[model samples]
Target: MSYDNNSAATPGYFNANRTATVTVNEHNFNAAEVNAQITAALQGSGVAAPGLGGWSTNGDVHTASVTFSADADYTFDVDYTDLAGNAAADYTQDKFTVDKTDPEVEFFDIEDKSANNGTVAPGVKYSDVNYMESGVDITIKGAKHDKTELSGNRTNIANGESIKMEDFKHDEETDDVYTMTAVIKDKAGNETEKEVMFSVNRFGSNYIFSETTEKFLDDVYANKPKDLVVTEVNVDSLVFNGISYGLDGTKKELKAGSDYTVKQSGGEGSWKEYTYTIKKENFEKEGRYSVTIDSEDKATNKMNNKVKECNIDFVIDKTPPTVVITGIEESSYRADEREMTINLSDNTAVKCVDVIIDGKSVATYAQKEIEKAGGKISYMIEGASEPQKIEAAALDMAGNETTSEMHKVLVTSSVWIQYINNTPLLIGSILGIVLVAGGLIWFFVIRKKKEESK
Candidate 1:
């Protein structure tokens, strides 16, 4: 009889329980006769009893199998008799090693070696820490025993080898949270895995506006002063530095929820959003103002007044422009070139000035004309036989308007009428003197001529 072993070979490591089988092929004997004659036993370093399953035969072939569970070196021995009833040669299998123990692994610490300042403490399940910049090395220290191979997501390591936390680094402008997993495996196919996580603060925090300062200044009807309304901000760090609001060149302190209100959303490795609204109470009246905002994230990325967008310079002018009528009296007939001046004043800037005469706009002076004229509109009242109603209207930059009260005056077209209108008091005095002289001459000369005739 001959035997074949179908199982682990000698000097091989197997962790799982496997059945070792031996097959005997003999044509002279049937399955039942061969089964009765063949016998098997197990011998090993940890085996106390030689336990083996009963032999079974199929046709002329007979097989016997044995299973092992414990970690030990083992060998199998089979004894069988030929069909002729003579004793057959014995079969011996080499040693089979079974290993069921897993290697041991331990992680001591994980640290960041970046330029920024931060702290990492042990926590449950992915706790994030701050000031970890991108492209900086990280160090991981650990211990491993009886390990055949080791590997990592970021770097490969030897079995149970301690890696320098400074060796693993990420260099990218985009911000992200990084996780490194170390896997250890033993010769018996046993594995252990451990992971470390940290956030990379590559992009710094910055302030943005819902409305541009220029656009806010343009849409002045919104009434309040046009200042920074921090929004669309992108903060990638887990730690947050608070926000501060102040007026430029002033000692005024702005209070949150009173002077301004803020709304924030999102978390680490995401686009953080902040909406800052300057409350109406902050601007009690209309005027020009400068607002300054400052803020930072956990990574010490700053957005402050130093940033041009964070420093807001704008004007608030809800009041209308003022128009003053000069060089003219309430009621008078003065017709001369450049006889009246319409002056405009505003808290902000004068956009345009209009001169209305007799309920109709006679002249319009735009920004260029107003600027050239030093914010004044000069006009001559045309000579007319009747009284004329004149008014001056002004518009400011903030879409506010003002119209002056009607100015009623009479003007003469002729030179004599102009002279008469200009010297009204002097002419009145001369007429009074001529009238008295005529009255006296009429009374005295007529009486003397009457007496002479009598």
Candidate 2:
């Protein structure tokens, strides 16, 4: 006779309802005397004999079994004897344990985190999403078990090594938040899992804010200071936007000290501010310019200023507008008011136009008026006997001014001179009549004297 039950328990582990049994296979005459002794015991509850009712027979086989019903470590033993009084080796099993418990896991306290502007939820560290851009250092701790596994956005994370903030950055288009799960398991197949969530901020458009109104500024004017600022915190390295192309088709980046200058404050874990002033030499000529500032946060995250707000685009209009005075002749005499048209043009839009006579501004037209009139302004200069130095001036948004060539006009504004110049046909006809009248009188006198003498 031998133990016949096949227990599914692991070598030294057990679950509910496991059984142990014994079987006898003999065709002897005295089968009624065949019997087996069985002893089963739970760890804390001393040993006891199982209720193994006399064996049941089927053909030449007899079998008996006992089932375990409680949760605990158990030990079992069995001794078998044949019908003819032949003894068999005893079978014994030890330390089959039943367990139903879970493990615990957690992350270590994160340090070296930047200042956060956002509020934190309970049990969540590094509260602000922007803080990740500057990068934080973290690791795992407080996990006790046979084996630990990690899953989610990040897995197979080194147990004690520093984890960079970039590791937690997920695809912003799909999900801006990142979650990681840590699972800890015990040798008895019991396990527990905990989740850690992180927020991330990726590259996007930036904005230029107005200090006075705290609103966005769409245009940059030359009258304003050439200051560029950033809102990101904890900036480490900065790269200004300026380039020069070589004859060999290669380009070189502009230098900070030579090409531009920078002033920075409040960073390395706090709100950061940067002011870049482009040198005047770079804008010696007048035109529109595009500039960019590319940089990296403390975590080595790239912050490119290629987007609208972050990029710099403005007119560097150092060149003045052109001015022309029409409908007036230089040094011409006029006894009546002469209407002159002032034409203005510039690379950019003209800001204003001024009509000046002698040394004072006679009239001024604003940008709107100039634009409404299509960059032309009509004005009449009062007639005067004395010559007048007239000039038309144009200005652009950059405060650049241009004055037209001085025109000395209305040199002789006398009414008689003006009449003589305009009524030439009438004067000629009157002079012809006087000459004919005098010649006719002289000829008649000559004829009368000749006839009398004859």
Question: lDDT: which candidate is best?
Answer: 1
Clashes of 2: 0
Clash pairs, model 2 backbone = none
lDDT of each: 0.56, 0.53
| TM-score for all models, in order of appearance | 0.45, 0.40
Provide the lDDT at 120 for model 1.
26
lDDT, candidate 2, 1-454, per-residue tens: 2323334323455333556555767776244553444444443565554455556778887677766554445556555566667766655543455444343344533212222213322121222111111222233322111222232233332221222232432332321223444444433444455566432234421323325312112444353335443333232333333333122233346578887776665534433445555554654444556555566555555555553234455565566789999888765564467888888898778888778899899899999998999988898888775668999888887777899988877644576655554445568868999999999999999999999999
What lDDT tens digits, residue by residue, belong to model 1 across residues 248-279?
A: 34546677776777787765444566677776
> What is the model-wide C-alpha lDDT for candidate 1?
0.56
Candidate 2 has its poorest 10 consecutive residues by lDDT at 124-133
TM-score of 1: 0.45
